[model samples]
Target: KSKVSVIETWLRKHRLLYVGATRHPFIHSIRDGSVDVSSFKRWLEQDYIFVRAFVPFVATVLLKAWKESFDATDMDVILSGMASLNDEFAWFNKEASKWGVSLTNVAPQKANLDYCRFLESLMSSEVEYTVAITAFWAIETVYQDSFAHCLEDGSNTPEELRDTCQRWGNDGFGQYCHALQSIAEHHLEKASDDVRKRTEAAVLDVLEYEVAFWNMSQGDT
Candidate 1:
């Protein structure tokens, strides 16, 4: 039986998450095993920058988790996720070598900058823990859902891309995303109506920004 999630239900009602999860041209092409090297490279470069900024954004969230939410398990998971970014950074460097691209001087593009700025906004004192963590869960799950499709039974995702896909799509990451969802849900349950609305809006904003970020990679922006 499938598990139920309030966030999942809310996201379904809105469709923003669905649009971001599916219909991303870059991810769709990867599923077909026909992603062009140029587009993939652009995605890699932009995503690397995003990940770099992601480190500190998540760190700030971890701080909030400690000071605000006081959820020990959630803090542990956030810490573990923060540790993994080191390996993720290494993977980007190694993957760049395999593809013969120089990532040494790449800069953040428009969509990525906007996304990072959104994270920065969440880091501000005005944003509550529920809103920030809701955004975190939404953003990570988008990538998880998008990439996991590539590993599906009939997917034509190329062997070369499968490793990258599985990096975010694998069972462990799925579990991590679930943990984040649980944390968000637990907080949301106690939240006032105003905070709940803000959280739902955060999810929508994350999806919109994610779709735009994907479009930027496809040169559609």
Candidate 2:
């Protein structure tokens, strides 16, 4: 299964943990149906925004890295990749703009420093949803506690930040999905079967790690 599917399965199977009386009561209410899941749906929408904001930045960095790794003479491959990546980014940019988000220069703000750090931590290791809602919880906490400050002083509003976080999370997820799809497409072609399987498995492993990281009921890492 794709990482997204695996993560979704984990979310459905797990009971997220919360801390303190406030958290306990909030969790109870949600689990007991007093709070409902409408807000969760909206929060989930933020995932797309996150993907829209950072994918281009990442693609650009990757292109440069690829250039450094290969010869400058391989301009054709680099150009083709750039073209494909540009098309993808353009599509995401249009989507983000419709959501009132632009990725032109979304520098990492002070408030988002922790968010970035936490994401880096996850990316550095092979941990799964054991982190639970480390990313989500961080964004939610920021939203509930410091969103106003972010809106007044940051590049995007509190809603935008939350949306962006979710989008990034989803993009990580989409990467795994895309990798798997690529593997499957190649599998049908009977070319480099071993490489395709390795790529698919690697993406699945990443997806598993993400799922484990997000499934933590204990709240922030």
Candidate 3:
């Protein structure tokens, strides 16, 4: 029998933590149409900052991929992702305006700062390509899964948030995430045992950070 992929094994082993990141109470509130607008506003502002920080991390990943990946298409996929960030920023600005959110004045919350720091750590040269890509996959997957849940059938996600939800929840984004997963898994299959262990730990850290980010959105410390 073919063995389970590294990512699949880790996901199964850490199912609860994965669920916590993707199905936190804040996400449920959004799905139930009970989300406080203040919470949404807080998330909007904080996430904009997070995405700004995320750009550098993605760039670092792209650079690593260019330097380490044997496959030229790896660079192509990552480059496309980098190019797409421009559109993402435009959407964030438009949405913030619609909601009266002033993105310029928003300060990063502690959770956000912590998460950004984690990204910075992964960008170091000492980190292996396998481990860094795994963290990248986890970080993007959490957002993709969480927001996609809000768009699922039977969810009562508010109309005002539907656009925001669709931005990440759409099939195209899902496909992009799948591409990232494929890249991560491919690298992981050939990684050293030590690198694999570090990758697993990084995935767990990403989940914790995601949960804390949601908590911060809800005004929790």
For candidate 2, write residues 1-221 as lDDT tens digits.
Answer: 53453333333444232122123332333333353333333323333344343344334434433433333433343244345445655655665565565555544333234333444544332422212112322222322322222223332334433443343334433443343333233232343545434433433433333333232222222
Q: Estimate every model's Cα lDDT from 0 to 1.
A: 0.86, 0.35, 0.92
Residues 170-194 of candidate 1: C-alpha lDDT, one tens digit per residue: 9999999999889999999889999
- TM-score on alpha carbons, each prediction: 0.94, 0.27, 0.98
Residue 207 lDDT (model 2): 37
For residues 1-221, write the lDDT of model 3, one tens digit per residue.
99999999999999999999999999999999999999999999999999998899888898899889999888887887888788999999999999988999788999999999998898888888888888888888898899999999999999999998888888888988899999999999998899899999999999999999999999997
Alpha-carbon error at 221 in model 3, in Å?
1.1
1 or 2, greater by TM-score: 1
Supply the TM-score for candidate 3: 0.98
Model 1 C-alpha lDDT versus the unseen true structure: 0.86
Q: Give candidate 3's whole-model lDDT.
A: 0.92
- Candidate 3 C-alpha error for residue 204, in Å: 0.6
Shift of residue 139 alpha carbon in model 3, Å = 0.8
Sorted by TM-score, highest first, which candidate order results? 3, 1, 2
* lDDT assessment of candidate 2: 0.35
**Best of the candidates, lDDT:** 3
